[model samples]
Target: MAKVAIVMGSDSDMPIMKKAAEFLDQMGIDFEMTIISAHREPDIFFEWAKGAKDRGVKVIIAGAGKAAHLPGMCAALFPMPVIGIPMKTSDLGGVDSLYSIVQMPSGIPVATVAINGGLNAGILAAKILATSDEKLLEKLEAYSEEMKQSVVEKAEKLDKVGYKDYE
Candidate 1:
């Protein structure tokens, strides 16, 4: 199975992007991370995408805000899947980033998550990899069950004490 590659447009996005790294770590998925800006470091982005397949990378998780082109660029250059996380910037609250990521050309598609939704991007990447990995599939199933149990437990607490009282 191919490992995931986590790329961000800037170091400023690391705070949001770290959630994806944490998720990958928890799920025991191997990943590589780097800051490769599509605008500032175009050559590096192209090089990374061109060699990603040979480097055994199966998916790419890219996070950027405003004119977010990293994900789309990577997807266009690489055959593997690319998950885009739109970071919530100060100006447009990340709507600009979302549109840039989601409005790909007909041939290229970047799977995009909500603004500042790096966690979901990580989980989706796990899901994509799990299609060909039995171990990852098992882990994902367990994770889903755990999430369900957590919600149920929270609801039970809310019922016993009432929502306001619990808080």
Candidate 2:
């Protein structure tokens, strides 16, 4: 069974949603990806959200642009964590999407990432899962160390060759 479910309102959201899927893949986490629009296909959306828990989905990442209610609605239906990725839209520069997902009412809350922040959402999902899975915790710790090392390497190179010429 998949541990994570990545959903989007449209195929256009795939470029962003793919980042989350890639991260989950790197973490050796199983996930399912699909397109489900809350507005266009309400019944299908409802069924997918309702059956997610039984399908062994521990976390959900939903990406939507304008009027981004997919994540919020998924949170309403699922008891587990739902991370909302606000895609950059042609209008309002995605602020609209960001606000729509983040402004859920009391009791129902969705963890929101920045606009086009699917990668961060994926990392957060991994961290959430790590809280209970020791193996995942180890992988996360190692990944963190690797990132720190990359930064250190970059800094060393910058020190060797000043910022003006630095690539």
Candidate 3:
């Protein structure tokens, strides 16, 4: 099975990046993680992305804060899908990162999640992979249904107890 690569620009992003890793682990999806800054180490980023396909990486989840270019750069270098998770930083509160990731040029598209949306990135990658694998597609469908059921169950319980009484 081709695994996912979880790359972050800095160690500070680990806390946010870990959420994606945890989600992938829960889904039984293999993933590898590393810290590589696009601005500081462009060569390393290019090499890693170029070699990702041969290394059996089907998808990449990249997280970065200000001026986030990791995901866009990877998308340009690799043909595989790239999911961008914008991390919240002090300066721009992640708006800069969000725009950097979402505004990709023609021919290269990077799917971007909300700020600090690591979990969603992981789930999106799984959905992409499920397009080809029947078993994974089934699992993804079941997961979505389970989430719906959980929300419905919570509403039912709230109705039975009444919100005022619970409070």
Candidate 4:
């Protein structure tokens, strides 16, 4: 059973949504990814949102552009954390989507990440799940240490090759 559900408004959002899938995969987290446009496929979207809890989805990563109603709607229907990844649109460069997802009603709140922030959404989901799962919590801690180590290694390498003589 998947712990996370990655939903997008269209397949065109795949390039952005895939980052969430990749992060979940790295953590050995099972996830289901699909397209369900709130505007074009309201019934299917509603069904997915309503059934997500029964389907074992602890967290939902919803990526959508334009009006970006998917995340907020999911928040309303699903009684779990919904992280919104607003894709960069050609018109407003995702400000419209960001605002739409972030400005949910007082009762319904969607955790909105930055525009095109799929990986952050995935990490946030893992962090939320880790609060209950000890194994996942350990994995998250190790992941954090690895990130710290990676940055230290990068800083060392940069010291070896200063910007003036970077080649």
Best by lDDT: 2
Worst 10 residues of 4 by lDDT: 158-167
Task: Give one digit per residue, the lDDT tens place, for model 2 in 41-116.
Answer: 9999999999999999999999999999999999999999999999999989999999999999999999999999
TM-score of 4: 0.96
Off by over 4 Å in 3: none
Clashing pairs in 3: none
Screening candidate 2 with a backbone cut-off below 3 angstroms (N, C-alpha, C), the clashing residue pairs are none
Expressed as tens digits, the lDDT of each residue in 1-167 for candidate 1 is 44999999899999888999999999999999999888987887899889999999999999988999889989999998999998898999899999999999998999999999989999999999999999999999999999999999999999999967996
TM-score of each: 0.96, 0.98, 0.94, 0.96
Question: What CA RMSD would you report for each candidate?
Answer: 1.2, 0.7, 1.4, 1.0
Residue ranges of candidate 1 with Cα displaced over 4 Å: none
lDDT of 4 at 7: 97
Q: Could you arrange the candidates by TM-score from highest to lowest? A: 2, 4, 1, 3
RMSD score of candidate 1 (Å): 1.2
- Top candidate on TM-score is 2
* lDDT digits (tens) for residues 41-114 of candidate 4: 89999998999999999999999999899999999999989999999999999999999999998999899899
In terms of lDDT, which candidate is stronger, 2 or 4? Answer: 2
